[model samples]
Target: MVGEFCPRLVDYIVLVGSHSTNRTSSSIQTPVILNRFPPTDHEDFVLPPDVALFCQPEGCFNVVGSRPARANSDSSTPVRMPISFVFTLTDKESNKVRYGVCLNFLRPIPRRPEGRKHSTSSVPAVGEMPRRTSDVEFSQLPLPRNSDRRQEDTGLHEKKTQRARSSVRLRTHTLTSLCLITHHPFFTKFRALVEFLHTLIHKLHERSRSKRSDRETVWGVLAGGIPSTTSSLVTRSVQEIEIWMLRLLSAPAPVPGKTCIHLAVQPKALMKPLIFALPDKSRLPLVDFPLHLPIQLLGISRTLRILVCLLLEQK
Candidate 1:
């Protein structure tokens, strides 16, 4: 029976569709080689070097384009076949593009059991019944019909619950590890921003000492005049941060929940030192400005606000 139902490999040849993502204005044209049917051997073919042909057994004359149904199976249900098609396309610039599509229909074959073989006892004589361990007949033995079935069902349910819990634990661990990897880039950029902000604050103090008549405070000067040395660096770092936040926002929820919240909270916590470093803050007269503000320096306030809102909404 197994030999009768054993699977067989088949091959086919068909044209596959191809599409280009380039935005060239000129239209594609057919190559001169394809104009002739069955071009000569000397002519170049469009097949790519990377593509390989499928290998099949020798002496097999049959070419099955469609899956064949089993002899005893119902005709209504037809088995799907593993078939593939290959085609080539040429653009107006004479560049060849090869396309291949394949349907995966390979199924795993069941392996036979292998172990030590045991010798079977000889059958009893024709008229004699088989040797019995007890007087009770097999059919007459006690059978807990409903109770046994209930026990079996309970066992199956417990096993399923355990498997589900283990799977969830595995997923959570994976998420945590990936979140750490994602956090590294954000942390590096944050450190750079912090260092630059500190330097800018110190530079503002130096400028205040040099120019006695310039009564503008450090915060006021920052609000009005951009620093020459760290302006581009600050802008690039802010852009990087915004990009990281956007990526974290777009990532799969629940998996990235902890990472997102950590990102939102850490920024507020670290900005405190930068705010304290600002000299003459009391005389700045900037009522609208926040004392402990990292966004003023980074310029990613709007993006950060949107990110926080999105994260909260997701929660």
Candidate 2:
């Protein structure tokens, strides 16, 4: 029935097995298939282990491993391990790729072979399988001598090892590319500046509390360290960046690079410019300025709104 519908279903089905020696017994090792679908162009696909076919069926539906042998079948026919299933796929070139699933099958240990005159007792029997590379016990291998050099040894080899170790530390910088605001050098500097400002503000408050009459001197000291021009420049740059981001968000389709800018500005009407949020959160309307806005400004706004509400309530 599968052959009639999916003619090339048998092509992708694969069987893999291995052998291992454990103590006095030997067993067949089955290779694992990580993916059912074959990779396409520019993609790498890991191929299964190459094993001699014990049984081949016409199609996935007619796979011998999944079915029981007939009651009257000859005993000489090896019973195929029935732990795998088959599936099909069609690629861009219209070629059918059949994929199969099978478990690793372990067979019972057999007696030693008898054919060769010089064959040692280590030789496997005619029906017995040989041990696979993965099945080799680590305890059986010869131990290596301790040849590690002390860190104090300033040889060329030690220097090379140190450099390699340092290079691994440098690899952590690669993660900075994952996010701009959180990982960019600019943000790092901005964070340091904010910390310095916070410390400065705390110091200023303590000084003002002690010398309540010397308000002008306190303002002068604060202005001296952080020039007005420098502060203005930083503020203008931040606002400009925010405006640029708002424009990008308002565009018909935002570019992937600026898709990180999700600061939603209120639109006058439904036909006004659209701000595209990440698809997961796009359904809800989000309106807030991006980045950490000045806390002082938020406090001032809250105080003014409260005063206006009080005035309205009294009227």
Candidate 3:
């Protein structure tokens, strides 16, 4: 639904397939032995494989062969990041979460607007997660090799190799991000989001068009990130952004960015400012997204509350 992506985002590719799973499972299923990203097999796997540890099975995903992806990382020490196998983004410390990863894969249980349906699925009981899938995909990454093999292996190696190659259209709820950074705009049902992005792009272009301004100023902080009810630019922008975020957070899709790990999957009240919980379990509200890409990164609300208690939370 959107146009092309900047070439910089498309250099390396790793493919993941989302399969349908029953969300009513009792607990976290044990992850498969070999996860590709976070490079479980190759040497780069010291950091926590938070994404693969979260997936049910297919530690298998694709990094196209015959074309080993090279990373520009020169740092001797590896940086810890969530594993979505876009190698260029994954390898660097600076790849602060690019936008456009799908988190929700199941059809949302449509609620009756008028009828009182007891919301049993809102929060998981103690240890249980409402959905079986994690927001990020945990799969093995293809380490670039100097040469391609003319022959294949047998038995265990054969099985692992074959299994690793399969995945696509495995689930209806899953979104396919073609060529890596290009997500189908409808991936989130948030129509207002595209509108806001188009507006934002135009606004940014308009502002940056001035030769005096060197930095592209597409960012600002607000009343916490959720915005107050007073109708203004910040309010309108926050509302547009949150429409999809709440869905991503509300039990299922909590369609997430890497920061989503910090945010609770439990639904937040629309009547209040949108908040996220830290690894420490401390509460922090969202203030603003300083980047065009919101799929992978989000910051905790620390800036000035541009608007006051003026609470008119959008449902």
Task: Say which candidate scores most in TM-score.
Answer: 3
Off by over 4 Å in 2: 1-9, 12-14, 19-97, 101-105, 111-315
Candidate 3 Cα lDDT to native: 0.29
Poorest 10 consecutive residues by lDDT, candidate 3:
103-112
Once fitted onto the true fold, the runs of candidate 3 whose alpha carbons sit more than 4 angstroms away are: 1-25, 30-97, 107-315
lDDT of 3 at 25: 28
How does each model score on TM-score?
0.16, 0.15, 0.18
Q: What pairs collide in candidate 1?
A: none
Q: Pairing residues by index, what is the TM-score of model 3? A: 0.18
- Where does candidate 1 stray beyond 4 Å? 1-46, 52-130, 133-315
Model 1 Cα lDDT, one tens digit per residue, 1-315? 001110111011111111221212123322111111111221333333222221111111111112333535543322332322222233335443322322212111112223435647666777998887565687688777898999999999998997665533321000000011111112333333333433444454445534532233342222223233234334444344435434433433122112222223135656532210111323432122243344644568865875688989953
Clashes of each: 0, 6, 13
Q: How close is candidate 1 to the true structure, as a TM-score?
A: 0.16
Query: What lDDT does each candidate get?
Result: 0.30, 0.30, 0.29
Tell me the tens digit of each residue's lDDT in model 2 across 1-315: 112122111112222222222313222333322211122211222232331222222211111121234435643222332222222233334343323222322122122233435646787788999976553676577765454344345476787886665543221100000001110112222233223323333354345434432222222222232233333334343344334433422333223233533222334563232233223333532323323343344676775786688989953
Candidate 3: tens digits of C-alpha lDDT, residues 44-119: 2233334333332433222212121234432221112122222112425533333332221111111112344467
- Compared with the true structure, model 2 gives a TM-score of 0.15
